[model samples]
Target chain A: MELAAERHGDMLLVRVAEPRIDAAIAIQFKEAMRELVADGAPRVVLDLAPVGFLDSSGLGAVVAVRKSIGPDRRLELAALTPAVARVFRLTRMDSIFTIHPATPGPEPTANRQAAPAAEASLPDGADEA
Target chain B: MKPEPVLAKRPAGAPRHPPDDPAAAGRAGAAGRGHGTTALQASRAPALQAPHCPDAGGRVPQTCSGTLRITLPATETGVRRGLAQVFAALRQGVLAGAVARDAAQGQAGAAEPVPQVPQSACDRIELVLAEALNNIVEHAFGPEPPAPATESRGVTAPGLIALDLSAGAAQLHCTIRDAGRPMPDGQAPAGRPQDIDAAADLPEGGFGWFLIRRLTLDLCYVREPGCNRLSFVIPLSAEDPPRPHGL
Candidate 1:
């Protein structure tokens, strides 16, 4: 449930500092994200680098967070750990969100087009995932 | 900021296992009575001998490859812990080594049926397990400690989930028993994926059963009086090259 937010230029980068986002913390996570994204930059990128696992409840929370962010602002996902990516892929939620690899270091205001992430083999230690 | 994970206080008859431990409670020994695996396990040698069960190694001795069982409270944390224990075994403990041995000694054990399974299947198994267990926690047990947790009604104590997984060469045969509310109409719901194209209002829920059905095969659910038993199978991943022993 540890989510750290940083202003990455025009975008806000919120790194999930926890190992998992499951049923146990789904509500809490959604509420926290609601607060964090309420008045941030026009774009919010959830860095799921530290997450080792995410279940259906967590998936729901992510979608709910998107809804709460409203239609005007953008909610993109970045650094999806293998497990997290798999959840999004299997559920086909990947189609909706603009996913990036490693928070897309260079481009913020320059490019709005979220190129599909090379999620097949992210170089994270989640080799196990 | 991570909010403190203190959920509603536990009832008087709360479980004794450490609270909200991702590892400790997940340390639920899932190796339940692997009957008849002792002799084969003994020959496989040293690493299998988990301290808890001397006669049998750290694995479920029921199958030549491996079988695992875990009994835990019907709580989110409990489910998380239970899943952790099984995968820990599958990756680092007896199950991994056994899978390795089965592949390495393929020529010799051609008679026995331990499919050449990939190591990655461990993750899928763990994922499906998390969903199934979480469903029981969120629905069956009804949001962990009930509202009147202080009532201390020994009559309606917290539920317990007993999950048994037998890792066959082809697929994983699983049986989960829980003392909780039965599935509506005593049937496993057909988890159909909703139209994601409706961009206006994205769905938040109903993905649990869909994932469970997607990742698993031949699912069946039965309610026996006071208990609910659900069983299913998950096909193993495409085979991979055999690794050296103790991988």
Candidate 2:
């Protein structure tokens, strides 16, 4: 699993370069994300446009990464391919994360501005235990 | 570690047919013909058999079902390879079905091309098969062996996974048999995906079976003797094309 991580202010944009995110690469994906966000970022956006297929194990790995980021930081998903998005929808994981239509780009302010109102409405520390 | 190959048989009462011999179609009785026409047969009878249509050169053009049967050790790489081969066979079967359908309508030599299984259906089958295969590779064979232990639980024991896929006009049927540990309570899990609270720790697992159940019809599982058999039917419909994005 190849992932390219770019830093935009306090947000990290990680793009999966693989067409598949199945059981074979699920663990590798989680480990890569953990390493990329080791220092922790205020927000992380996983760009899954290149991923044409995502199975349950891959979905779990994404969730595991989100939890590993802890409560202070948030993990969002962006640019999901139809097939990957379908998995998220079928599993109802879409409701749990802030999803963007496309990559928010280099400008962190643009992302904050484009963030959905529902995401903005989240209570402070709501994700914290 | 490679597990040994375990012989697998079709679930009790499932219609038995020769493996990939087009000539055997004539041997199948009328009842088998009905069973092979549509996935509806699976719903009506647990032992639904497949149709044994005549050869392509025969006078009557019928929807001839194709079957691919293979047994492999319960290893990750082996499962992956097996799935690839099975999917290829399924694609060929679908194409053959389309040709048979066209021939039945006297459109075999027409200028217009015969319709094939939609990309959506193929994608769904691939997804579902991946999940199923993964489950067998991970759980069925039991846990990995200790560092010094050369053989894993299933690797040393009678650990093998056999897959049989039958492709027809209305649906694709897959039968998976494994000589490994049975499901907890000897029954398939019926749990649905649980609601997640974002404020708490997000769930990292438990979605495999739910996806399988949602994507398939007439799903059934049986634990018989020393093996477990799981079979499911995936209906092919043009209306439900896979969306590339969003809900």
Candidate 3:
């Protein structure tokens, strides 16, 4: 459950340093994320580049974090490894979040619109706000 | 970061051959004796075996395989260790088969490469195992059942989950047995996750069975008098071209 949080402008980037997010650490992850985003920025970008595996519980934890953040704020995902991306794709969760190819640097606004294919992959009304 | 090693290395001089007794072997073997048996069981009666095909050297490699069986209490810690140990056994079996294949080709002198299981296959297996095992610990055992309650009192002592894994050249077979409540209507759940547009109605659970059904082949669930057995086969990837014999 190694997670690092940093503030980059209005967005808070939380990177999961572990390679796996399974039942073993799913609850811990959700609690950690809740604490990180408790009094932080509205926009969040979860960097999952280092995470090579994510099970259903891990996927559910991510969804739980998003729901905790509320709909007014956005919970975007960035730098999903192929294995992690496949889980999201198979579960159809790719439709729910704005996913980026990598962690966005300084110019966050441009990165949001960088991956249009991801945007196109989202379900209806997911792109709102 | 690379995924943490789920399987540990076997101790030096550990027994290579499976136990002699058929009942012991079936209980400990990767493949179990059952009505709905997989191809591995049909071709190799005892345990998973490397193919006997002769290599370019015209020598058939001796089949080498092993089975591990352990019944653990249906606790979170127990489930975690059970999954890790079984998965590790599966990995070892696959690697051993690959080594045998390489030896048949007379490439034993070449640096023994660290056998690599395909990442996609590994991911699918991990995901399915996690969901299934967690479901058992959480639902089947009813969170934390009181210790020492007699079965006659309708309170079973630390439910037991037994895992059997067998790895063949073309596929890996897994069988999990548990004495827990049967699924609703005595049928395994099916279908995809619910289609949700509103965040309020989004589901946090109920995705376990769906993923298990989708990722596995020949998936079957049967309820015996007092136990539930779930078995599935995961096909190995054929992307890697056959290694040139004696290369």
Candidate 4:
């Protein structure tokens, strides 16, 4: 998996380029997030659009990232593919994080308290399969 | 001295194997015709006999619900081969049990129900087992063989690597042990060491241990005098307790 990060306003957007995030890479996922949070970014958005699969380990790493952001800071997950979304449902973590459905339009605007997402169209190059 | 076969006559539809067949030793591909049925019959004994362990420390942990051990040479290839064999057996056993239970609960022509842990879990099992076995190959095998290993050789000392599998009512347990030096301080030999403060954006090593920790409910590492042992357990079911109380 490849993780790329950039600063946008007070929020740091970390994009992971990978096919799956599970036990195979959970450790690296945690480590990469820890590195991103070390800068003390008040908000972080994790783009998992590239992820094709997510398991319990992947979920735990995301939770750890949320905790790392601290209560004062904000953490959000974006561009979750349907397959990845199923994992969130399986573990019921969908209720815990801000999951912006991968919409066909531009990236969803950042909101400190992310508004609840409604089913939306898919972005280009993002196949439902 | 010839002894009566512990296995009873094969049942109809059960695969048949000669009493001395090594292929039927492990629960992999060997079709025992009605081996599942035979195993069901065997399981009825309920002698409370736990799986065997070759080493004293190989004893099942108090938290473990059940345990089994398989022996293979302590070589790179041997460790890999042994892991594949044992893991397949465990998965097959669980799959067979689920199938038998569903069939027994229903009549013929009924749909064969699927297992909770589907075949997809096979990949996850491989990932988890590989991490545990890697420790044995690297740390347990020690620095390097005093002499180069060759494929044709047989029965030579290949150091000491043992695969121990235990299952709690709610969890699946795997332990790998080797007679090697104690783990270095904060520096694991085989994979990345535990790091709590590393960056989240950089692509780097040190993810395997973290994956192991996240994948398993609990992990324990022990360096007793001569052996380095690593054990990990994952909950067997989403609804079941990790292990039976007092087990």
All DockQ scores: 0.39, 0.25, 0.22, 0.03
- The native-contact fractions of the candidates, in order shown, are 0.57, 0.52, 0.32, 0.00
- By DockQ, the better pick of 2 and 3 is 2
- Where is model 4 more than 4 Å wrong at Cα? A1-129, B1-66, B74-76, B94-116, B142-158, B186-204, B238-247
The true-versus-predicted C-alpha distance at residue B185 of model 1, in Å, is 1.3
Q: Answer with 1 or 3, whichever has the higher TM-score.
A: 1
- What range of 10 consecutive residues in model 3 chain B has the weakest lDDT sum? B33-42
Pull out the clashing pairs in model 1.
B26-B81, B30-B69, B34-B61, B34-B62, B115-B169
The candidate, 1 or 3, that scores higher on lDDT is 1
- Any runs in candidate 2 off by more than 4 Å, and if so which? A106-129, B1-65, B91-95, B98-113, B145-157, B238-247
TM-score ranking, high to low: 1, 2, 3, 4
Q: Candidate 1 docking: what grade?
A: acceptable
Instruction: Give stretches of model 1 more than 4 Å off.
Output: A106-129, B1-20, B23-65, B96-106, B109-119, B146-158, B238-247
For lDDT, the strongest prediction is 1
Ranking by lDDT: 1, 2, 3, 4
lDDT on C-alpha atoms for all candidate structures: 0.63, 0.60, 0.59, 0.49
* Residue B19 accuracy (lDDT) in model 1: 49
TM per prediction: 0.72, 0.68, 0.67, 0.41
What DockQ would candidate 2 receive versus the native complex? 0.25
Candidate number of the best DockQ: 1
State the TM-score for model 3. 0.67
